[model samples]
Target: MEFRGLGFVPLFIALWCTAWVVVSYTLTVIYGHAPLLMYISQTGNYYPENITFKIGFLGMSNATLVLMLLQYNFILLHAEAFGARQPMIQRILLAMGITSCIGTAVMSVFETDFYPVTHRVGAFCAFACGCVYNLWQAILLYEVPGIRRAICHIRMVSSAMAFIGVITFIGCRVSVYTKLCTEDYEKIIEIISISTEWLMLLLILIQLVTCFQPMQHLSLTVSRKGYTICKRENQDSAV
Candidate 1:
């Protein structure tokens, strides 16, 4: 059976992410101009609190990340329980969310100024997990029945964007790190990678938009204990 729509909660999670992007972008603008090749995290650092954006941005972002992760955790776990035949897929989704949350927190706290190497490690973890997370989500989006009719195309497009972004970032990293590209070329590649990152994020927001309406068709209820209890109803009633 396919799950058609995502519950209202996921939309809230997407909103948090949007907030993160806006705040971070605004902060970067307020500070002295940062080169495009520089990572977004770099924008959060080395400036006075009032003058810089990333400080407040990361703090708020971390909170949102935690909330988003927790929401996905519950969502996927419930999916696993009901979607028995594909337990592994559901489990992996949950794992990705948790790992991404950890990565976000680590990257948020360990700024380039205070912990350059650690910061990079956190960034790598977050990006890699986030990419894979989207990839898996794409699979589920296509395979799941209820929402697939409307979202299959969306999933394909969003996942494709995510993969393109991941691949470009990897290629740019290899070129920059190996000194295979000139400084100017490397900078340009880095900028392209950043653009792809934002593109992937935008796709996620789009995916959430599609998921919101269909959740109503799924007979998922929140019990008194605040747990998601998926009890599929008769087709007529669900509709």
Candidate 2:
């Protein structure tokens, strides 16, 4: 069956990843302003500095908005799929997803150079909440009928990778902040930290792809009251 609304997930992933790649490359290679191992936020630190900074800022902001819309779609898909019989776990997942989306927006808006504290808080919320959401989602999917076992396995693996990435990223970041390593060691630690951050982000986006199958049979409609998601009838039959 043709999936409706699956485009949102891919669009979110593509926009963010492209932004990161283009901005990071421009700063490190073309502009020679930032180191290769600099944090993602560093690429967009001074928005007035260059066009790449503006692109990074705008890209992340737009991606966060798309992420929020994707979360809403997931909530509606769950509501229609399970109806009133939906479990509390589903509600909790929806809440976590929304919280992560909010965190993403905050992080995108508050650059680390200008708003260090707020940016850190937003990053903490986005990564921590998002990691928990992925693990919990994997567990919940096991209980859901008709979901493929392979998808559940993939989710579980992706969640574990994200969890590991978070821990490694935190450890390396803390080591750098504390000056626990020598000057030479600091660069290595920084590289590891940045790499893990990228890994965590990519895994989070990958996990969202698992939802595409579940959403294949669903479609959204809007009426005078509000928006509603409904299962699509077989197109062949309608024809």
Candidate 3:
């Protein structure tokens, strides 16, 4: 069955992603200027208490990431529980679960400055899984013999997201290793940091879009296959 209004799901996610961008820009305007100074002095020069801006910014960004992670988690769960008819989906679920776990651990390390390693590892795991899933879906779309056009569209979106994910993951690693905006490379670092944050927003947008695809697919499938709809609805609603 053809899915109608599926485009709206990704658009909605893009709208939600705007909030993170706003928060990030606000933080940049407020406290992102002299990160090196703050790092050295271990305090903000002006309105020291406003350091909350950075914390709040990070919190909002992390919250966005967590929301995306939860969405993947739900998809993985569904694949495991109800996708026995599609065994390839089971492998996707495993990849999603592994990446989600890594993402969760990296996200949980907000208490320390040493989260760089955790973040890099988590991003790598998630990026790898995204690439694998996208490639698998792309191949499946070609070989399945039906719904090739629709799956091809999904493949395009998934591959784009995978590319963005890998780039963002590598960017994070570069930011960590290079220590941008330090006394030595002050200007370069600032640009890199801001660019990293912007890239992060894109990654979040892609993840959210990817998450909503499954819901739209399920909705369309149920609408097309009425007999399976009842059983599918019962099973999906339980999730």
Query: Could you say which candidate leads in TM-score?
Result: 2
Give the range of the ten consecutive residues with the poorest summed lDDT in model 1: 48-57
Identify the runs in model 1 with alpha carbons over 4 angstroms from their true place: 1-6, 33-38, 46-85, 217-226, 232-239
Give the winner by lDDT: 1 or 3: 1
Model 2, poorest ten-residue lDDT window? 230-239
Q: Write the per-residue lDDT of candidate 1 for residues 1-239, one digit (tens) a residue.
A: 23433355456657766765666666566665465445667666754422234444455345445444543443454463346656566566667766766776677777777798887677677767866776666566554445546566776677677767777877787787789999778768877777776676687677666555445444444546664534345534433
Ranking by lDDT: 2, 1, 3
Pairs in steric clash, model 2:
none
TM of each candidate vs. truth: 0.73, 0.75, 0.47
- RMSD in Å for model 3: 8.8
Better of 1 and 2 by TM-score: 2
Error of 1 at 24 (Å): 2.7
Distance from true position, residue 5, model 1, in Å?
A: 8.3
lDDT (Cα, tens digit) per residue for candidate 2, span 126-189: 7887788778767656655556799889989999899888878878877878888899998788
Candidate 3 residue lDDT tens string, 161-181: 556646664665466577743
Q: Tell me how far candidate 2 lies from the true structure as C-alpha RMSD in angstroms.
A: 4.4
Model 2 earns a TM-score of 0.75
Error of 1 at 86 (Å): 1.6
